[model samples]
Target: MMSDDLFETRDSSSREVFTRYNREDRIKKASEKVRQLHDPDFIRKRSFIKSVTENRGLRSVFFVIVVLVSINIAFFVTRSDKNNGRIYGIKTELKSFIYQDRALANLRLSENTKFLESLKESEEKDGALVRVNFIFLDDKGTKLSSSLQTGIYMGTELRFSSQDESGNAKKVQAEIYIKEKLLVLSSKIK
Candidate 1:
């Protein structure tokens, strides 16, 4: 009976020690979990990362839109208009004779005014003449025009003057037409 009591006491003490150890392990696990949940640095880092990912998607979309818009604008700006005809070169020059005689100048001035009035009527019927050299080449044929009477084929230099309704020398422009369609337009200001 004494041996049986001693065995019972040993078993009871061993069970008590196991139970105490199990309780301590459970407390440690719960506290570790709580600590992890309440950590300020970890929470802040997680929230900041989550916010950045959300905003990054929106920012990336915005950046792509901006880049596409910029590309379209550049393309349109660089593209040339095909409707308006091409102009190669424009040149203008003015020449005037000087007279020193006062009485002769006064007599000539009145006559010049009368001549200018007559010239104005004729100018209204025709577009202003511009000294130009134009060449048009296509599958149909080659057409050329120039200020020189010999035409552009001979490659001769020429000059022409244009006048406004007031008989004053002014800017001149001309449009070349083929089959009622504008081929080229050129102008010169003097």
Candidate 2:
């Protein structure tokens, strides 16, 4: 019992001494800071901590502006195509029609579009079968919309024979809607 009392007394006294030492150290540092704050030379001197506090707002504002601008530039760059101007925004560019076939590799895309234009009307009048495909791009040439391999037909859809070419058969038999992403909505309907 006596040893326990001694231990308690020692622990309490040690804790009191430790706290008093910390208090004295803190008081000394605070007085030094107060003296520096009053000194013209210290005020004029540019220290790392001083500069950080003085330009805190400027630094944060500049960083925010830079980040916003970088995001805007990235968005515009990602939404653009080589052959076209701004897309996925305003309709600055007209809609463009592209043609593809088994022999598509033989000719360039421009050549195929030209070829399709000439043949499209003739084939339509003759009631020949034509195929159309679309790709929805997200941005940065990173993500391409893909059709699921459902069965024999890719991007498969069921249609009624009676309703085939039924919507705009008299005017135009084709429709390729891609929001405002292309130039030239479609070849001018004859």
Q: Pick the candidate with the highest TM-score.
A: 1
Query: Which lDDT tens digits does candidate 2 get at residues 54-173?
Result: 777967876788899999999877744333232222222123222331101010112123323434455343222322232223223222332211111111221111111212211111
Tens digits of per-residue lDDT for model 1, 9-123: 3455453443213433444457766656655565533564455457778668767888999999999766422222322221222222222311100000011233334435664
CA-only RMSD, every prediction: 21.9, 18.8
TM-score for predicted model 1 compared with the true structure: 0.23
Q: What is the lDDT of residue 49 in candidate 2?
A: 51
Predicted structure 2, TM vs. truth: 0.21
**Model 1: lowest-lDDT 10 consecutive positions:** 102-111
Extract clashing residue pairs from model 1.
none
- Enumerate residue pairs that collide in model 2: 94-182, 94-183, 94-184, 95-182, 95-183, 95-184, 96-183
Model 2, runs deviating above 4 Å: 1-54, 81-93, 96-190
TM-score of each: 0.23, 0.21
Query: Which stretch of 10 consecutive residues in model 2 shows the poorest summed lDDT?
Result: 101-110
**Candidate 1 regions off by >4 Å?**
1-54, 85-126, 130-190
RMSD of 1: 21.9
